[model samples]
Target chain A: MKKIIMEKEAGRFCENKDIAKKLREEIIEPTIREKEPVIIDFGNVSGATQSFIHALVSNVIREYRDQAFDNLLYKNACLEIQKIISIVYNYMQLD
Target chain B: MDEKWVNVNPAQLALTAALALKVGKENAIIQSQNIPLSARYLDRMGLYNFFSTPSPFRQYRKKEPAGRFVPISIIKNGDDQSKFVTDIIPLYHLSEKNSRILSYIVGELVRNVLEHSFSEDGAVVAAQYYKESNRISFAICDTGIGLWKSLQIWHPKTDKEALSLALTPGVTGTTLELGGTSENGGAGLFFIKSIVKISRSYFVIMSGDSEYTLLKTRPDIKNRLYSDPFKDHYAFSNSISRFNGTLVAVDLKLDSTPEFQKLLDDIGDIYDSAVKESRRKPARKPKFI
Candidate 1:
């Protein structure tokens, strides 16, 4: 399993898409390709933008479909962050 | 320009700041003489800082901005954006719940500038809290490619058309795909507009020679979110003096704000349906034998 701590890279508010892109390219995509589970920890992240959340995970969801949902996990997300995550997930999964 | 009285909102102030930056400090000049007493608010808002010309008003003690306003600031990159978001909440004395809404707006708008606008001068931003109205008004302006230019890939014929597409849910300059590219969902402006709409506030966007303003929702009107921007009560003009960049301003009533999570849930649902509906295939015409 691969663990990525969001606060360490994105500070308290995770709104930087550059960092999101980097994490997706460097960590999330690689781990998912290896067929290993990945956990993205949002501990200490007070808030996040829908764009930030979208940039971070939308590609994985697009490429991997069900495996991405089953293998990827979000940890310590506040209600706001969870809503944003769900928004991205729903729209991206829509046919 | 000199007037007997001066009144301006955060959006106007941010635009002035951006213009000053664009004109360069040496070329930029503010008429300092015979300035109205009401113009002191301009000085307080830090407008003079961007100009090489001296401030017309006499120097006063610098006051702390907490619980009142955030003076004009320039956000050039991600680091600057993050720091601004962190520092702005205390400046407004906003509670955690309130801060989330403001942060979300700032984050999405400024990031739009950094990633899409391509303005080396970056985004000029300012905010003010009104005690009487119990609301906050903020604006972001960039001296980069305007909406028409940004949406050229999608073939927006005019600035007005570009503004319309920009506010449409899930339509982004990055890609024509239904869900948008991985990096952009094209939902930032739509989300911001919905928040302001539900709060019964005003939202405005200007680019090139066109501008679109979402008029304040009347109390008697039922609050409804629309995927099409023009369906809402609004004022639009295509004859405004051409501006080479983009400006977005919003007035959000703090008192009227619904719970942040609930607001998102409602907006999310509307956004999903809009995307799904857009992707729906058209019904086939009856076949002629």
Candidate 2:
């Protein structure tokens, strides 16, 4: 199991979907393929928009299915980021 | 007062009044032939302690701040826009979540001004926070080619039609041949509309000869994420006068509980549905409000 601090990989502000897609491919994919529990830390990330989180989470969920939740962990999310994650997660659950 | 000031356009009137108040000369007798759009907006926006005299065009101003209108200089680039967010957040004591929302909105709107407006002078933005009323108002104006003319190069549309289409997602005037990037998803107005609707904010957009005003009617929590297309929540009308550029005004409740999670959920759902509708095997057109 390994932890990925988003602010360390990206910057304090993560708003672009293209950057989110890149992060998922570069960091999250390898971790998932190795079957390691990946804890994604959002500490020090000032803010994130719906586009970025949607791209990062949806792409992984599309590939890994419902099991993505089991292999992944989210941490250090402020109220703002937490809200964004909740929205993305709910939409992913929808039909 | 010069007679020319009497017949000034809405933008000029608004700017003149703002400058007057800024310079601490709120009381000034104005003589005009008719009540301009600017005066009407000033009355509606609750700016300055002023009243029209017995004559329709003549008004007397009193030096008092009727509204907490914050004066913002022209925002030409990202740095200026960021300064606006920083200034506004502290002025309103906005929650961190609300600050983020404002940043996203202002950032996107200003970016459009820089990228699409082709305005030699750039854009102007202003804000007002009504603490007692628990509301905040923001306005952005750009003296560029209006939406109708800008979009006409791609599709021939009336002023009203151009304004309507501008609010739709993935409806960009920039074509692939024009070197627009894939990220040019044309979602700026879409996101703005959605956010304003969800937050129950009053939104008014005027460009050229057309204007659209939307009064928020939904509750903070609603059964649907988007507004009813046929509802009277919005109105599209032709104005008596034309603006050479675009002006957007928004009035939002400051007391809003930041239900950002739900808002984000709605945005995600809308985007997903839009994508699916476009790529469906059977071929289907996406529905937009």
Candidate 3:
């Protein structure tokens, strides 16, 4: 299992699309390919935009389909972050 | 065409010059008592170069500067874009919650330029905090393919119709990939509109050859579209204009937590109702036709 700390990767503001892409590529994609469970740790990150969460989580859901749920873990997400993640995840499922 | 000097408000003059330059009408040769002043202001802000000769009182232009009212800044790429939201907005002395709301509103508008404007020179952002008026005004502008051209991929639309669809949630002009930095949900303007609607913001979107303005007043009626009580706030207009690309301007009341929270709660309620409705509807059995 690989633990990816979002605050370390994207700093305090995890709201940029390109930064989200870098996070997805560096951590999520590689871990998912190895069929290893990846823990996305949002320990100190403050807030995120829908676009950023969409890039980080939905793109993977698009690639791995339903299996993304099994291979990924969200850790230490604040209430706001959890809400955004749920919105993006649910929106992606609609598509 | 004839050249004439028109008397207009300073802000209107600025918008006229900016729109003229945006639509490739820089050489139209019309002037105003305030147009020259507006020109000098835009020139300093790096918005338009409508004037060939510098203002006579160049020292005043330099000493006072245009940022007094219109704090204009150009955002070229992603780095400036992020810094503008996370860093610059907090300097205005707003509450944390207010900062977040402004950040979301401004971020969404500017992100639209990054994702869809496709302008070579990038987008321009301008904002003003009117302390006396208890409001903040700002605009995000781009010189790329206009809304009509972008949404033509989905279907042919007049500039007015394009503005309508752009404000409608789940409607996108292009087939953007599901996710990856780009704004994929097509909810940028929709969210901003809802925010403005709740916060009693005066909002305007100018693109192609049409402009749309929504003015909020007397909080009586619900905004049917967003399911929020934006009632008695129904000063909406769709007019013909010659602006190219897209320009979104907003003047929202400062510190509107109640309105903003109501918007969020409304969205959550709608989402819950949708899920419950979907669960209630039974799946249909497959039948040969």
What TM-score do all the candidates reach, one by one?
0.95, 0.62, 0.78
Q: What are the TM values for chain B, all candidates?
A: 0.94, 0.69, 0.72
lDDT of 2 by residue, A11-57 (tens): 56665455666777877777877777788899998777654675577
Please, what are the lDDT tens digits per residue for candidate 1 over residues B42-114?
A: 8889899888877777776766788788899999998899889887675777877788889989999999999
Lowest-sum lDDT 10-residue window in model 2 chain B? B176-185
lDDT string, candidate 1, A1-95, tens digits: 99999999898888889999999999999889888899999999988998999999999999988889989999999998999999999988775
Question: lDDT: which is higher, 2 or 3?
Answer: 3
iRMSD value for model 2: 6.7
| Cα error, candidate 3, residue B124 (Å) | 1.1
The residue pairs found clashing in candidate 3 are: B221-B231
Candidates 1 and 2 compared by TM-score, better number? 1
lDDT of 1: 0.89
lDDT of 3: 0.65
By DockQ, the better pick of 1 and 2 is 1
Candidate ordering by lDDT (highest first): 1, 3, 2
Model 2 pairs in collision: none
